[model samples]
Target: EMVMPGDNITMEVELIAPIAMEQGLRFAIREGGRTVGAGVVASIIA
Candidate 1:
């Protein structure tokens, strides 16, 4: 996905199974050698 500079972005994921069983996920938003932002998958159970 393309995002404009200085814009806020949000992401979500739904899992059928328990998040504990999963190794989790990783994300990286970068521009060349610089990393603009990053995040990790958090367990949010319903």
Candidate 2:
């Protein structure tokens, strides 16, 4: 999905596959083809 500055963003994910105890999931927020923010999903429920 493409996003512009000052835009609001929302996301929801449903995990159907098993994730390992030590596994890491990464997410990146980008604008103008450049990354503005990045983080990892430390944990998820449901």
CA deviation > 4 Å runs, candidate 1? 1-23, 41-46
RMSD of each: 6.7, 6.0
Stretches of candidate 2 off by over 4 Å are 1-23
TM-score of each: 0.32, 0.38
Instruction: Please give, for residues 3-45, the per-residue lDDT of candidate 1 as tens digits.
Output: 7677666677564565453336676657898988776655544
Query: Candidate 1 — what's its lDDT?
Result: 0.64
Question: Native-vs-model 2 lDDT?
Answer: 0.64
The number of the candidate with the highest lDDT is 2
TM-score of 1: 0.32
Candidate 2, residues 1-46: lDDT per residue as tens digits?
Answer: 9867777655555646875533266777578999996656665655
